[model samples]
Target: SAVISQKPSRDICQRGTSLTIQCQVDSQVTMMFWYRQQPGQSLTLIATANQGSEATYESGFVIDKFPISRPNLTFSTLTVSNMSPEDSSIYLCSVEIGLHYGYTFGSGTRLTVV
Candidate 1:
């Protein structure tokens, strides 16, 4: 099993500001993923980070808005660039537990832009 920790459980920021979130894992993992849950919405995949490679983002997400970095096997970071009120959402870090167990997510970083 892998344990993941995220910083800034909640924060409020001004428009046009950016916030960087850190994700640390207790165990080395092959893949780490980022997700967003807007108010009253379901979870959506932002990107998938793999060690030694660029992050693969999902549809409707671009690197300029949500840049990701995976420096090693146990750590990664996601930066929410150029924040806006529309960007307000719960950002979460996740990793697959096992072939049968599926993915496990961090508690989430709640961001509110105003």
Candidate 2:
């Protein structure tokens, strides 16, 4: 099991501003993923962070917008660049221990853009 922590539990930003959220894990995980949950919507996978390599982003996400950094095995960060009100959502960092263990999610960083 891994315990994940995220910073800035909630934030309100003006349009065109950006925020960077930090994710820390207690133990090294094989797969670290980032997700976004819009209001009343399901969680959408943003990217998968692989150690010693560039992050693999899912569809509808680009590196220029949501840049991810995995400096080491147990730490990662996501920067939401060029923010817009449409981008407001709960961004969560998650990790899967195994197929049976399912995924564990961070409390999430609730971002609101005005």
Q: What TM-score fits each model?
A: 0.96, 0.96
Local accuracy of candidate 2 as per-residue lDDT tens digits, 42-96: 9999999988899999999999999999989898999999899999999999998
User: Model 1: residues >4 Å from true position, as ranges?
Assistant: none
What TM-score does candidate 2 reach? 0.96
TM-score of 1: 0.96
**Strongest candidate by lDDT:** 1
Assess each prediction's global lDDT (C-alpha) against the native.
Answer: 0.93, 0.92
- Alpha carbon deviation, residue 109, candidate 1 (Å): 0.2
Candidate 1 per-residue lDDT over residues 4-112, each given as its tens digit: 8998899999999999999998888899999999999999999999999999999999999999999999998999999999999999999987798788788899999
Off by over 4 Å in 2: none
